[model samples]
Each structure stands twice: as structure tokens, then as C-alpha cells.
Target: MLTRRRFLLALVGQTILGWAKNLFAQTGVFLTEQEAPEAVFPEATAFERQVIKATPELREKMQALMGKFKPSIWEDAYTTFLAKKGGEFLGYAVIVEEIGKHRPITFVVGIQPDHKVHDVAIMVFREPYGGQVKERIFLKQYRGKSVTESFLPFQSVRSVAGATLSIHALARGIKKAAALVQAVYQEGKEGGW
Candidate 1:
């Protein structure tokens, strides 16, 4: 009887553990690659996709602009969308990823022609909690921010109560995005550097 009871208890514990794992492993895909640009550039009538490679020199410039070296932000290549309205260039949008707690959070950062942040949208949120980071109140803080601006928490950027990690990840990701756009499309460079 003792052995039978122990087996039953073990089985129950294993079952509970499995359920908890599944609960936390859920992935939420709020937007797709195509839809993200439309959401970020609502008024734009046209969007041209461009694939930019990350060369050694470009990476070095990005590092200098970002003021830190984060490998996760520097992929082999980046897919960007150039938005236009009636033949007028509006801005660029780039998709970036950063770690939130344990999993990666995908964000679509829209940058204006002047290099300021136009908007930020989350494409995929893998963490179980901290979905509140997607809320407008948290993301709106990024608008109008430039590569020269500070993304530090509680100053230029606001932090969520339980989503501190996610917020920090987003701040870093946005700063990286701004720096990328600056390096690729600096003022008066013409056709980018």
C-alpha cells in the first residue's frame, strides 16, 4: 500500500509540472511580417521592402551609435520597409528581437525620416506574463525618440510594474533600431551609407 501511494503521488506531481510548463511556454503572435508595416505606417500608400546586410563596418557604426554591443540586436541581415505616401518618403520600419525574461520578444520599430521613433509594435510576445508591455501606454513612450535620446528606464522610457524585463528589452531594441536607421540612412548621405 505504501509503494502504491508513493507512485500515485509522483504521478500527480509530474502531471502538475507538465501543465505548468505548458502554461508558461505559450507564444502569442499578435502581428505578422506583412501586417506589421501596415500597422506602423497607416497613412503610407506604399511600402518597399529592403534587405540590408550587416557588414563589419556597419556593425561597428551601430555599436558606436547604440553605445553598447548587443549581439542579439545585430543579425546577419535585416528586413526593412520604406514607407511612402504619394511619392513622398515617410519613414522606415525594421523588425528586431530582444530577450524578455527568458524568451525573445519581437518588435517592429517605425522610424520617421528625421530619425525619430514614429511607433513601436510587438509582433510576437513569448513570455507568459508581462503582456502589458504591449499596452499603448507602455509603447507610446517611444514615439519621437531619436538615436541621440536616452532610453534609460524611468526617465525617457517608462517601466511597467511586472514587465520590467520586457520593458528593458524593448528599450534596448528600440535604441538599436534607431541606431541602425541612422547608420543606414543618415542625413545628406543620399542612398544611405
Candidate 2:
């Protein structure tokens, strides 16, 4: 036996879900309303309103726009989401997990699809000294290069020479971010990923 309040609440949830489905039918993305438990990926729990919403129309668009990338259906799914929401896929956040290109510390970064970096937020800094590497002075170097797909060689490409650890941390974060973007791009390759 359900109470009237419980029945109304269930109805509201279903309505919201239906509306979400319809919105994604047109847009392919939904801002996550709250943080999530650790399940989607490491260090990626409780993010800003950023989530994927897939639709038939969105999938088709991703297939056409990024056909050359040879992405999988899943990638298409994500890309479709990004493109439909907006061509840049800006504001999608990820949690930094490794210490490649940098050493002795791991940090968190916020990035956009067009490769635009939002913030190089340091979630954890286990380094010697004042942790100046935790500042944007080193991380800001990654702005605009988020779409490079692969780590740009320190030379030939612009970087903050002064902040070595921070620069490397940003680079490593960028590299990780590029992999996510590339993963979605590659997903349209043929099968699903």
C-alpha cells in the first residue's frame, strides 16, 4: 500500500526522467545535478553538472562530423553528446589519476573538449617545500592546448619554464584529458568502445 505522498514522488521522478529523455533527444547532454559515487572512474566522484545524454539524432551527427577519427559507437555516443550540447564540449570535468610527465605529485584538473582548461585545481600535493606547483602559474600553461590529442613536446610548444613540477603536472593532466577526448573520438572508429 503506497501513501499519496509516495505516489506523487514516484510520478515526479518518472516525469523528470521522461523530460530528461526528451531533452537528450535534442541535446545529448545533461548537467549532473549532484556528485556521484566512485564507480564511473577513479578520482571522479561528485562533479559539476556534467553528464552524457545520448540520442539517435546526436549519434548520427557525431558519426558525420568526426567520421575520419574512426570512433566507436560509444565514442560516437559521447561525441554526439558533446556536439549536440555544444561543438566544443567545454566544461566536462575529469579526475587526474597518474603522475606521468610529472613526478612526486598528483593533481586534479578541469578541462574542456576544445582543449580549453578551466582550472588546474590540486586535490592532493605531496611534494617538498611550499607546493608552489599547486598554483595556476604552472597549470595555466595548458590553456588552449587541451585538444593537442598527445602531449606536446616541451620545446617547439609553449610552456611555463619557471614552474617545472607544476608545468609537468599540467602537462600530465592535459595528456590524461586528451586521452579522454581521443577515446571518444576513437570510439567512432567502427565498433563500440
Candidate 3:
């Protein structure tokens, strides 16, 4: 026994869900493997993928280092690419995805060998409100920032007027990725891991 009001509500809910699914499907592979390397390392002649597994000890250390936990972006393993030019190391590039408002935003972050951010590019931005995050003015602020820097939204990191959440999520994701590289790749390599 379905009331008219109940039927109408169900129909609307289904319609919204279908629309969201279609939107997500359309955003598949915003940044392909070929393009990511080029964007992260414009002068690189080759690149290598290194997978860092997040063991229990590693996860605990990351949590301590970041001072905050974001389960969505922090996974059990991360695939980071090392860009090289004629056998000389150029830098590192990592792609991270974080929840923005109701959907996910994917971006690629490039870090120099000195641990400073070289650039950040928005690969997939699903939220319609914060498309401005892709603008150079906003993304440029992240350049030269490192894991040692404070990435607090509206504090160390400037926030967009209408895209506060997106900005915060991007900053946080970048910080996490940088920290991962520092703790796992750089430090681990030095420690003879």
C-alpha cells in the first residue's frame, strides 16, 4: 500500500541518485597516467612507480606526524611516481583524492627533491561550487609549501570565498601526501629500509 506522497518522494530520490551516478561516471580518469607524469615533471624523460604500504607502525607514525586523521584520503598504500631526467632524479609526484562537499576531488601534487611543493593541479573537481580551486591564483599558494609548513585553512592556507570546504580538503590532502613522502620515501631510504 503506497501513498501518493510516498511514491512521489521515492521517485525524486531515485532521480537524484541516478543523476549523481551519471555525473561521477562522466568524470572517470580526469588525469591519465601519461598526463600525470608530464604535469608533475615537465622535463623528465622517464618515471618510476614506487608503492608504499601503510603498515600499522607506519600508519601510527603518519597520524602522529599529521596531527590529524583523514581516513578517506589515507589509504593502506600509496602509489607515488619518481620522475627522472636522463637517469638524474628530477622530483616526485603523487595523486590524492579527497571528499569535497558531496563528491570526490582528485588532484596531482608535485614535490621537489628538497621537499618543497613545485606545483598542484586539479584533475577532477566534481563540486560545481568550487571550480575556482583550479585557478592558478589559488593553486599557486601551495607552491613552496612543505610538510613542515602549517596548512590550516584560513590560517596558513588561504580559503576561497565560496569554496572553503574544497580549499580545506585540497590543502589537507596535499599536506598528507607530502608527509607520506617525507616519512616513508625520504626518511625510509636514508634509514636503509
Candidate 4:
């Protein structure tokens, strides 16, 4: 009942399906949007979304903080969260992304009012080999890091062997997040939330 032509057609269909499945598997979502904010600010009872635009001045400031390498994934607008507990301001959380090898890796970075990193969480990872950057051991290094601190891998932040590019990407994203929050939430800034 099985002819050669039919068998070849079935084989091709299965191969195509397998390739699609493998491509899907390379992208992983570790946390949802709701969970990311909660994970970064566990004690906060409420979160307020704040949309901030990238003005020319703000972009210059970010560039100064980031040095030579600019974040390629930055957009004209950004959405950050203000976490509060009992009506008291807790901190700010911002989602940022940077290219990891071939794909973008997204992260949620929490910054305290004092401009220090409180916590960090990975929302999505689009690369297959660099998922190790999402591990707690790698993420904990960013805690307490201020915008003035250095994120150089192997110097301040440790590196994962196979995830070197990912480590660099995360370091850039964290620094950019901290800088953005500090610039936007500064006492005399136009849009201080």
C-alpha cells in the first residue's frame, strides 16, 4: 500500500515539522510580565506603569553612561514600573533587551530609590546556548550594583563558559536599565515618577 513517492512526501513533511519544533524550542519564556515585576519587587504590593520617551538629552546621558557600545535594541519609548508598598515608594523596575549571540535576551532590572540595583529577572531568552545567564548565580552579581559600577565580565561580574556573549549582553542591559531609571527618577527631572 506504501508507494515510493508517498513515502518521500511523508518524510519531507516530518522533516519540516521537526525543524519548526526545534526553532520554537530555542526561544524560552521563563517569566510572564506580571511575574517579572513581582519577582523583582517581591515586597511591593502595587506597581504603576510609567511610559518614558527617549529625548535627545536622555539619549546623550545614556550614551555617556554606556560608553562606546550602545544598546542596539533600544527604542524611542520605554515603559518602566514604579513599585510601591502601602503607598510608600519601593523602587523602579525596567525591562531591557540586548542581542545574545544571534537573538535578543530580555531582562527586568529593579533599581532602588538610591540608584542601586535591588534585583534582576530574565523575562525571555531567545538563544539556545546562553540560557545559563538566567541562572540565579549569574544574576545575583548585579544586585547592589549602581550605575557608577562596572559590569565587565570576569572583573566585576562572573562569566559562564558557553554563555560569554549572553553575559556581555546582560551586563550592558543592566547598566542601561540602571542609568535610565536614575536619569528618569532623579529629583529634579521633568518626568520623575
Write model 4 residue lDDT over 1-193, tens digit each, in one string.
Answer: 9999999999999999998787566478998877888889999999998888988898787777667667867767777999999979989989888899998898899988877789998899988676777888878888888756667677788877778888888778877887787677773765333
Error of 3 at 181 (Å): 0.6
Error of 1 at 142 (Å): 1.5
Worst 10 residues of 4 by lDDT: 184-193
Model 2, residue 150: distance off in Å is 6.8
| Candidate 3 per-residue lDDT over residues 1-193, each given as its tens digit | 9999999999999999997776455344456755876776788888898878878887776666667646356676776889899979878888777787777888888888787888887778778566677777878888877656766566677777767878777877777777677777777554211
How does model 4 score by TM-score? Answer: 0.79
Give stretches of model 2 more than 4 Å off: 1-89, 100-104, 149-166, 184-186, 189-193
Deviation of model 4 at 54, angstroms:
2.4
lDDT of each: 0.81, 0.43, 0.74, 0.82
What is the number of backbone collisions in each predicted candidate, taken in the order shown? 0, 14, 0, 0
Q: What is the C-alpha RMSD of each candidate to the true structure, in Å?
A: 4.4, 19.1, 6.5, 4.9
Ranking by lDDT: 4, 1, 3, 2
Off by over 4 Å in 4: 1-26, 187-193
Give the Å shift of residue 175 in candidate 2: 0.5
Candidate 3 at residue 101, lDDT?
Answer: 76
Model 3 gets an lDDT of 0.74
Ranking by TM-score: 1, 4, 3, 2
